[model samples]
Target: MASFEINGGKRLQGELVPQGAKNEALQVLCAVLMTPEKVTISNLPDIIDVNKLINLLQAMGVKIEKVERGTFIFQAKDIDLDYLQTEDFKNRASSLRGSIMIVGPLLARYGKGFMPKPGGDKIGRRRLDTHFEGFAKLGAKFNFDQQAYFYSVTAEKLKGTYIHLDEASVTGTANVLMAAVLAEGKTTIYNAACEPYLQQLCKMLNKMGAKISGISSNMLTIEGVSELGGCFHRVLPDMIEIGSFIGLAAMTQSEITIKDVSYENLGIIPQTFQRLGIDMELRGDDLFIPSQESYQVDTFIDGSILTIADAPWPGFTPDLLSIVLVTATQAMGSVLIHQKMFESRLFFVDKLIDMGAQIILCDPHRATVIGLDRKHSLKGIQMTSPDIRAGVSLLIAALSAEGKSVIHNIEQIDRGYQDIDLRLNNLGADIRRM
Candidate 1:
């Protein structure tokens, strides 16, 4: 369990480039299994989860070649089904939640797919019922062995059908999209997740000869094709990382230029930060945040209190709520941060309160943060990272504090961000891994 020892109050400067989208990379990489031709994907982030998935793909006999540092050429011409059935395969597959995406491609190409229970951040109860239900609606039979903690799906021939997901589950939509691309006839996914990640998936599939309409809407129409071809795909910049950098700049009172941000793809992120009274300038494809002495939280037009909440695509993403919450601790007023998606995500505010921030954790989903208004800097303290987003939020808080702070379980942070400490250090942050 490595930790991050940080000397707070170091204002990061200069230009920084955000890494490729981690969530998008997970979905797009799984799509490689849908086609046998050489699929070239660029802007791949060097993170633990993505790397582990690449290794799992290689173990399953997918031929992989490095095109460059952030690019890869994958050809899944031959897959070792026997190898996939081994205990070693099950153990590795169960280690990451993104690995569950393999089921869609595997079931589409082969007749069956199986895996043990998937693992990821224990922030809340993330159920796979959406994935299973979507698969079953697409004419696939679903099975789960409670004793073995395994799930399997099978279909002799998948027939397109109408699927209205119970919730707009991101990975669920991607999994079904992967399966539906190669099915027969038309498949309609109502209430689909139209995030940039899913949109990129749909676009990449279309480039590979899959027919998908409604690129950025709640309803998606897919015309099933017998096969798909390989195509080149460059993932969009990680919106979550971009949002984090915006929060980092405001929290630490720093000036930063985030290069090549793909501003068009970041729908509501920039505006969300603006709501926090943070000023940012858009310079071509980059985002420039000037150093700020103080920022205030805006109340509603009726002079009511302010609320920052998360929603689906075209709405503020839930992933950045933790960053928003932690950053609000230093603002000039109060704000209610509502994390509707995950229940336990807000529990980490207790650690922030211990560090001298005024935070009221209202149940499992909401937290009220009273800003310190830059009057008194936070006192550093030892803390445990709860999950990926919370871990990064804590890192941001630590960087903005007065003294030294130590954060344990930094592996959680590594799972999402690529070389975070090294990259932040280059920008003048004091973060040491020990």
Candidate 2:
């Protein structure tokens, strides 16, 4: 029931150190269950989803110790497999999408695994059929009950095989990678998700003795190994937060510098934003966003209207489309945004329309945004965060609007960004967490 009260129309100017990648942190935490030795992860973000995942791991008897402020030492040497069947475990397991990944490691190490339906953004129907399908292909049998989804594999030894995933689902790819690492033969996953988060998972697995090739491509080759050892790995910076900061600076007419961003890993993000006429400078590893009065949407070379769409990794991320849509509302021109990954993601544009934004909801999957160009200021109003990315988008809108705005259901925002209100406050934004 917490909310954010934001007084809008302030120019933010300061330097911000981005936190560790939330997506990678979740996967790395679950990977600890695959080994009995100690695993140390550095640059961990202090966020709610991570804390919840850590609590779930601790409940299952994983020993976690804080080595430093943003570092942790975790050892799953004495994991109690029985905890995975309890009611408390089911409730906690169903609280986040990252919890689904535990099934692979558990089933690979232990013969069986059980978890309830996972929870995440309600943007659309996120199916676990892909995960189960990939697991079943890897010799795991799946069963469902009224209370939870149960998975058990009867094969005495798992034998790897080729898997062509139905879609390049991020978590699905992670599950398959985790399961394939301990199987018997060579496993080739075609049409995989090669995002930076997945790449980090691959690197960490290699550190733990998993033979994985094709680090940043769709075709992943994994040679199953008998045992995995412990190793220390550092998680990457949060690119989604970096994208959010880019959107915030453009929307509020602010000059801000984001520090420690992995410039090379930002494959298409920088160029994607440039499509909207938001130019950014990379000073070594940092990103600098200069203050701008208005951004213009670029047109096609042939003089047709520009269209920006989301695709799999190496393409634009579906998660950042919300931020782009919201930021485009305050830009100088018009563009079409197509969010192909989720059906319900574009439904939040109605909230922006209520705030006097010029948006045309073409359908559930696409919208055309006409920028207001600093000529019109969005009026303050009460709004609810429908999902994680949309929550951050609404916060940006609230911050760019004229009076006071209240954003309810901030727990969704807490799932991804770390201390968002406080960080924005440090950048001279008038945001208070209430």
Candidate 3:
């Protein structure tokens, strides 16, 4: 269990390039299983989760060639189905929530898929019901082994049908979409998640000879094909990391330039940070955050308190709400952060409260933050990272605080961010891995 020893109250400056999207990487890596031809992927983030998925694919007999640092060519020519039932496979797959995605491509190509109960951040109850339900709607028989905590879906041949998802779950939509691409007929998915990552997946699938339409809408149409071929794909820059950098800049009063951010794809993220009074400008696909003496939060037009909440696509992302809450601690006004998707995400505010931020944890789903406005610098203390996003949030708070702070369980941070301590240290941050 490595920890971060941070010397707080240091201003940083430099150009930071965001890594490839982790969420999209997971989905695309699984998509490689649907084709036997060479599928080339670029801009893959070197993070724990993505690397784990790559290793899992390799274990399943996918031939992978590293063309460059963030580029790989994968050919799933000889996948070993029997490996899925092994204890080693179960132990590896059970540790990654992204492993659930493998079931879709496996079912599409092999007519059957099996997985141990997947694991991920302990943020909340992230159910796999949507994925299995969508599969069941598409003519797949689902079974669960309660004794082993395993799930399996099998089908002789999947026939596409209309599916109105109960929730616009991103991974669920991706899973079903992957399965539908190889089904026998047209599949229409209503209430689908239209995130950029999903759109990227659709585009890559289409390039691989799968027919898909409604690129950026709630409803998607997929025409089942005989088979899919390989295609080259590049993942978008991680918007969550971009949002984290924005918050870090505001919290530390630093001028930082984030390079090649795929500015257009970052829906409402920049504006949301601006709503928190964090000034940022677009400089030809890059985001420039100037050092701020202080920022002010905005209120509703009718003079009500400002509220930021997460919803399906086009709404603020729930992943960044933790960063927003931590960033708002130094703003000039107050804002309510409602984490509608997950209940326990707001529980991290207690650590911030200990760091001298004025936050009211109204409930498991909401928090109200009254900005200290830099009148008093936060005093760092020992803390443990709860999850990936919250870990980065606490790191941001510690960077802007006074005195020394020790952050334990930094493995959580490493799961998402790539070499976070080394990257931040390059930007003049005092983060030492101990």
Among these predictions, the greatest lDDT belongs to 3
Give the Cα error of residue 280 in candidate 1, in Å: 0.3
What tens digits encode model 2's per-residue C-alpha lDDT throughout 1-434? 99999999899999988899998999989999999999999999988999899999999999999988779999999989878768888889888779999988887887667778888888888988888888889887778775345444434567799999999988999988998999999999999999999999999999999999999999999999998999999999999999999999999889999999998987799888888989799998999999998789899999888888999999998889999999999888899999998999999888899988999999999999999997999988999999889999999999999999999999989988889999999889998889
Model 3 is weakest, by summed lDDT over 10 consecutive residues, at 341-350
How do these models rank on lDDT, best leading?
Answer: 3, 1, 2
Assess every candidate by TM-score. Answer: 0.99, 0.98, 0.99
Q: lDDT per model, in order? A: 0.93, 0.90, 0.96
Sliding window of 10 residues with minimal summed lDDT for model 1: 79-88
- In candidate 1, the residue pairs with backbone N, CA or C atoms under 3 Å apart (3 or more residues apart, or in different chains) clash, namely none
Question: TM-score: which candidate is best?
Answer: 3
Choose 1 or 3, whichever is better by TM-score: 3
| TM-score computed on alpha carbons, candidate 3 | 0.99
Model 2: worst 10 consecutive residues (lDDT sum): 146-155
State each model's C-alpha RMSD to the native. 0.8, 1.2, 0.6
Which runs in model 2 stand beyond 4 Å of their true positions?
A: 146-155
